[model samples]
Structure formats: structure tokens, C-alpha cells
Target: MEIFFCKSWFRAKKCPTEMWCEEQAKAAHEDGKPYTVLVGSIEQPYCFLEVTRRAVGVSFLDQLLRESLSYDFQEVEPGILFLTMATYREFEGDTGKVESGTSYIFGRDGAVTLRREFFNPQRLETSASSADVAANYSPKPEFGRYEDLIRVERSS
Candidate 1:
């Protein structure tokens, strides 16, 4: 699975528009800002899950239907598997929210992570203002945000 972050991140890192920073994206959620985190499926039925991008402030809800090939998972249940490291989003996609969180990476063996998505009601209002507006991009039907994923990999 590939995850999509706000494209404006380039400006935040003082890098060229064509560049990306893994550290920057990993720490992006630590600020507690309200940001859109879109996970794209790399399969036949193409779709985008903005489950973690709700308008609420903190509803603490489950927000993912996951299938990962990055690591070997021992299924504790038919539909549930457990692993040690995974990515979590508790802040905005931008630098607006001050909520603090950290996303861990597995490095070599691959990461098995679960993101706990929370919803904010005030953010759903028509006039609600936030600094974490999602940047626009075209999602690929085959790999979702494949380019971003590659960038993260090469940055290592």
C-alpha cells in the first residue's frame, strides 16, 4: 500500500518542488495539525481512503483496511494480523495542528504499522479554517502514490 501526503510538503522542507524528505513526512504528523492522509490501494478496484482526513478534532476511530507485502505477518485471526512497527497519523497533514506524534520506520525488514485515525467535528463545518489543506495530485490506478513512495525509499 502507498500513502499520499500533501504535495505542498516541498515548500515546507525548503527543497525543490521535485524533491521529497522522508524525515519531513514522518514528522509531519507530530505537530497535531489537521491534515489529509490518503491511502491508495494498488489493485484492480482502485480507490482512495481519506479515512484519516475527517473534519473533527479527535474522535479516535479505526480507519484502515490493510494488506501489506512489505513484511511477513503471522495472522492471529482471519482478517487481523499483528506486527511491531507501523506508521501512525495523529497530527494535521501540515504544520497547523500542534498535536504531537511520531511515525516509525522499519528500514530493512519492512514496517508493519497501523494508523489510528481520529475525526474532528469542528473541521467539518463549511467555514472551518485550517492550514493543512491537501495538495492536489493524480493517483495512479496501479500504484496509488507510487512516485512519493519511491522518493521516500531513495531518500534513505
Candidate 2:
């Protein structure tokens, strides 16, 4: 069976030109903010889930939440969340193919997490917003904001 790994992420804003991190790009241009600075392996098709399962005791989500604490969450619009899950695809003809495989966003409340499996790509689904997850998970303020990446790194 071809088991696919799911990569979940939240970007504060979509770049207008680059099509990703547009807000951050603008921030970099206007406020002189540094690169969002993703430290993970930029190599395409990197399996974070696999890495965590092999190297760490925590799950991928846990690692992500921990890392998110330092991202720039304040740049996003209030009440807006950009959640996405994508796979890595490589074709025989393509030399460099780390392009986003598939993704969906939860822009409203009451989104559904299909199959009840967080790692299942086919099971990854969303509603209009986070109301359902909030109701089901009984998320606290901290938990809700866990998705927010607003941490600003102070330069020495």
C-alpha cells in the first residue's frame, strides 16, 4: 500500500505574488521583518510525521504546536485561521516536485475532521470554521490561540 504522509500547517497570510506568506512578504517589505525562517528540511517530500515517530516521543501535531509558539501569528486577520494538510508528490518526469499536493482551509466554525484520524489525508476535512472542534475539544483560550503564530524575534 502506498501510505502517504500528511503535513499540516498554518500560514498567517498568503503572499500576493509568491502565493504563500503574502502578508509576511509585505511585512518584510514594509516593516523590515526578517524571513519567517522555516528551519525544517526544505527538501521536498520531507516526512515530518515519519521523522517524529522515529526520533521523538511526540506526535507531529505536538511538534508543530511547540514550533508554532514562535511564529508570527499577529499578522493574520482576527478570527481567521489558515489550516492546511498537503502530501508530497513526485512524478517520473518532474525533477523538483515538492509542490503542495492537496490542501483545504477552515475559514468558519464547525469544520469536520474526517475519519477521526488526524494523520489520514483522506480523513482530513474541514467545516466553515472551528466551532465544532471547539465544541468537541472544549478548547481553552490558549488552545485556540495555539494556532496563532505571533511571536516576534528580537534581534540582539
Candidate 3:
């Protein structure tokens, strides 16, 4: 299965990224498999939260149903139309917050799995001491590993 990532702000009207997602959704439906779409927009702060919140329990299935109806994809049974948003925020000094990155696993059973991460440099600083900062900060193992599973495309 091919995963698509749209690093553009989402629009209400059909955009190239959305069109690609729709096509992938349709193909997954035809193949009787799940579908996932990752979207990144710096302007939308709540996009990641909303997607994750809706993905817990039965709500995710309900969300997929609603999206299928809205996007006119007919029916997507036992499928997950996963969407995510990534953004970054910088502070006054050298501090910053990065809410970004997503991972996917293609299971042997033909299921799609997702994982997301949020990194905040401010949280790593316990005090003004460099030792404390060094002790608290460690590179995330999952960082930079998501590229193995996704294909990124920019919209015009």
C-alpha cells in the first residue's frame, strides 16, 4: 500500500492533496483494506489533536463513515481514513516546540497502524544549568524513521 503525505494547508474545496487522498481511499475500498492520509499545516493547531481524539474507539469508525459520505467514496468497510497535522512553534529565545512526524506499519493482515510524536525543547530544560538540560534531553528513537513508510507531495 502507498501512503501519501500532504504538507499543505487543507482547504474546504477539493485540492490536489485531497484529491489524492480520495483516490487512495477509493483504491483501498476496492482492495478491501484500510486507508490513511497524513496532512501537515502550520496554520492549524488543533488538527493533530482532533484526528487523534476521533481515532479512539468507535468514534474513528464513525468518523470514517462521515468522511466517506462527505467525500462521495461510496462505502469504506473496515477501513481507517487516518489524517494528521504537523506544526512548529518557536519561542522568544532558543526554545521551540515541534508537533510533527507520523509513522505507519503495514501489518501482515493488511492493516494500517499509525504513530505520532510531539517534541518540546522547553520541557527538556529542568533549570538554567547545562548539566540538567543535557541529562533531560535524549533523541527520540522514532525520530526520522517515518520517512521509510510515507511519500510526501506538495500542492500547488
Candidate 4:
């Protein structure tokens, strides 16, 4: 799967040229598989502002999709790929903190099969400062099955 994270317009100076972005979009469209162009914004974290489609035309690339963060995941399992991204921030003076994480599982066809998001509740509630929290913090293990199947036998 070809996944591109496009930066918003205000950051145009840091983005690729309009023509280059269009060429990339055109190539992805021609491949005829699952390709995603996600528009990103500074105001939003852990989510995309928009998912651009080919039908929108190259002109749309001018407005968005200029800067891209591309990722090419190799199949970890048969026909499956996994990706994870996280953000951890500690406020100045250890007054507060923010921790957010997300994971994605993609199929060989370039479709997302599973997505998981995690956040620290302490960040929202009145709790100890970041330093105090860190002193007692212990990372917890998360477990789950990515796939499940069921079979039934008919009684004669």
C-alpha cells in the first residue's frame, strides 16, 4: 500500500512543488490499487483533515497534498502489514503531559483492516504532575487477535 501524508497549505514553503505532487498522484491513480493521500494539519493530531481522491483532479493537489510523508510497509504476515505512530509530550515545568498512540493493520490489497487508538486518561484528569506520574508509571501490555474465524457443524 502507498500511503502519503500531505501537509496543509500554510506550510507551502516546506512542501514539494505542485507539479511533483501531481505527478505522484497521477502515478498512484494509474496503479489502480488502494492508494491514500491524507491531508494533514497542525491543528489536528492523530487524524487526517481530508482524504483526497483522484476524481477531485490534479488541481486539488495545488491546494493540498504538496508535502507528503510517505510510508512503504513490508508484509509482516501473509498479505498483511502493520504500522504504528505515537506522540508523547511533556509540558514545561512538568506541569502536565500528553501521550497518544495509534496502530494500523493493512491488507495486501491496501485496505485498512484494523485501527487502534490509545490515550492517557491522566492527561485529562486532575492528577499528579508529569514527573510524579513518571516515577510510578509502568507500561501495560496490550494484547488482541488481529483475525478470527468461526466454523459450525450441523447436527444430523
Candidate 5:
């Protein structure tokens, strides 16, 4: 039952602080990212997020299929593969949208390359905001407590 505020421009699992908006505000400001505070929680929040760098191994997918909230696996063409993940929790304000996130697998120089990367603060207009540290795989909201984070297999 931690406090997440609107002033917080960012949220991540395992965030560095419980009162992120308050404690980190100074650092975020020094880094040149200014944001207004808003009120939120796991059940009702602004948006959902996924980090591309936190890739789940291919072997894990088989088991994940059993618990995935909503998902789609397809071979668009040849060696290229596409995967879409959804929320396992049923909620009205959930951030995981159907097919909103994507990744690719392809052949590269005789080796297979899996290009799955979701977090990229550099690409964001507010790179300073990217400073938030997330302990969870992502900042997306869910019904359970952090310890009850969805099964690692199904989530990745």
C-alpha cells in the first residue's frame, strides 16, 4: 500500500523510493525534467509500460501460454516472429493493450537475433524522466501487490 502520485512523471516496479514523486522530485528537477503531480495507484493509473531490454527467453513462451492474460504469436514471414502480450489481471484501467507492444526475431550473420527492447528514455521527449529506477519488469499497474507480481514466465 505505497503512495504513487501524479507529480511522478514515472513509475516502475522496484522503484527506488516508496514516495517516488516526493523523494525523487529534486533529482528529476536537477536532471531537467519537470512534471506535475497527479494521484494514482495500481488499480487506477495513467498508463502502462513495458521495457524491451527485459526480454523473456523463447523457451519460456511455451509455459507462458498457459497463464498469459492475452497474447498472440505469429510468423509474419520467414524467420521473423512477432509476439504480443496482454494483462492476466482483469481490470477496467489496465495499461496492457491488445497488440500494443511488439518485438521481432530474425536471422543475422548466421546467428538468430532477437530484437526486443521496450525501455528507451533517450527516445523520449523527456529523457530526464527516464531516470526512474524500476525493480519490477515494468511500471504497468495490476491488482496484486508487488510481491504478487504476475508470474515471471507469463509476464515476460
Candidate 6:
């Protein structure tokens, strides 16, 4: 097990020895505009070809059904993809909130966008402490052992 922290302003000023990895890919578009597509992964793969695939070629989440097919992704026919760890987090308070951490997913097509706090582990201020700042305050309590699961598929 391992712990990780976010690399934000607060985190940068306090701690300089943190690991935050980002993943990106070059997608070919029929329009000739090179689209940069990236996603978070939990494991390292031998090649990108093992992960990239088309919608018709791969399986996708049911929630993505309504998402614009032109921008969403699909799994590879063989169900092969990429895996990697994009970010990590630390305990912030008694409520189980993430006090400090870097969310690798963001932007329209970031590898690890969309942070949903389904379970409030901490009762800390949601606005007072920014994610980047919390990450800087202290290292993730037990992030050294946590593992993120990464899967790559064809860009829509």
C-alpha cells in the first residue's frame, strides 16, 4: 500500500517531493484536427494499441450511452486497454473528506476529471481548503498502498 498527494500551490510550497502522473494520447480525427485524448490509468501496459479501440469495437459504461458518441470512448473488441495511476488523496478530517489530494482527471477530456464525493469521510470545509492546498499540507495518510484502475479504449 502507498499514499499520494496532489501537486497544487499549497502542496508545492510545503512539500516538493510528491508524485502526480498525467496521461495523454494523440487521436486521429477525420477532420484532420489532431485531437489530444488522455485518461487516467492504474496499471502500465506494454503498448497503447492494447488499449485503444472504437465504440463498435469495445464495451462502454451504460451511463455513457447518452453521452455524445462523437466525443465518448469505447472499449477494444478484445477488451484490452491501458492501465495507470493518475492521482491520489489523503484524509483531511474526521468526516472522511479528502483534505489534500490531486485529482488527475479534469478538463473536457482529462484523464481523471469529475470528482464526486459520494461518501463524506471528513466534515472539513469544502470551500475553505482547496484540493491543491490540502495535498500540500501533508502527505496522504495511507496512499502508499492504494491503487487506481486504468482502462483505455477508442476515443469517440
Q: Number of the top candidate by TM-score? A: 2
Where does model 3 exceed 4 Å of error? 1-21, 29-34, 37-45, 48-156
Model 3 global lDDT (CA atoms, 0 to 1): 0.26
Ranking by TM-score: 2, 4, 1, 6, 5, 3
Write down the TM-score of every candidate: 0.20, 0.25, 0.18, 0.22, 0.19, 0.19
Clashes of each: 15, 14, 0, 0, 11, 31
- In the range 110-152, model 4's lDDT, one tens digit per residue, is 3443333335453232211111111111111111111110001
Error of 3 at 141 (Å): 32
Q: Give stretches of model 6 more than 4 Å off.
A: 1-77, 105-156
Write one digit per residue (lDDT tens) for candidate 5, span 43-111: 343221221122211111111112124222333344332343322322223333222222322222222
> What is the Cα-based TM-score of model 4?
0.22
Worst 10 residues of 4 by lDDT: 146-155
Please give, for residues 6-30, the per-residue lDDT of candidate 2 as tens digits: 2323322211112224354344434
Name the lDDT of candidate 1.
0.28
Better of 3 and 6 by lDDT: 3
Judging by TM-score, tell me the better candidate of 1 and 4: 4
- The per-residue C-alpha lDDT of model 1 at residue 86 equals 28
Compute the lDDT for candidate 2: 0.24
How would you encode candidate 6's per-residue C-alpha lDDT over 1-156 as one tens digit per residue? 222222221212322122343211122222222222122221211111111222211111122121111122232224322221123444433333345443233222233443323234533222212133111111111112112221232222
Residue 146, model 6: lDDT of 15
lDDT agreement with native, every candidate: 0.28, 0.24, 0.26, 0.26, 0.28, 0.24
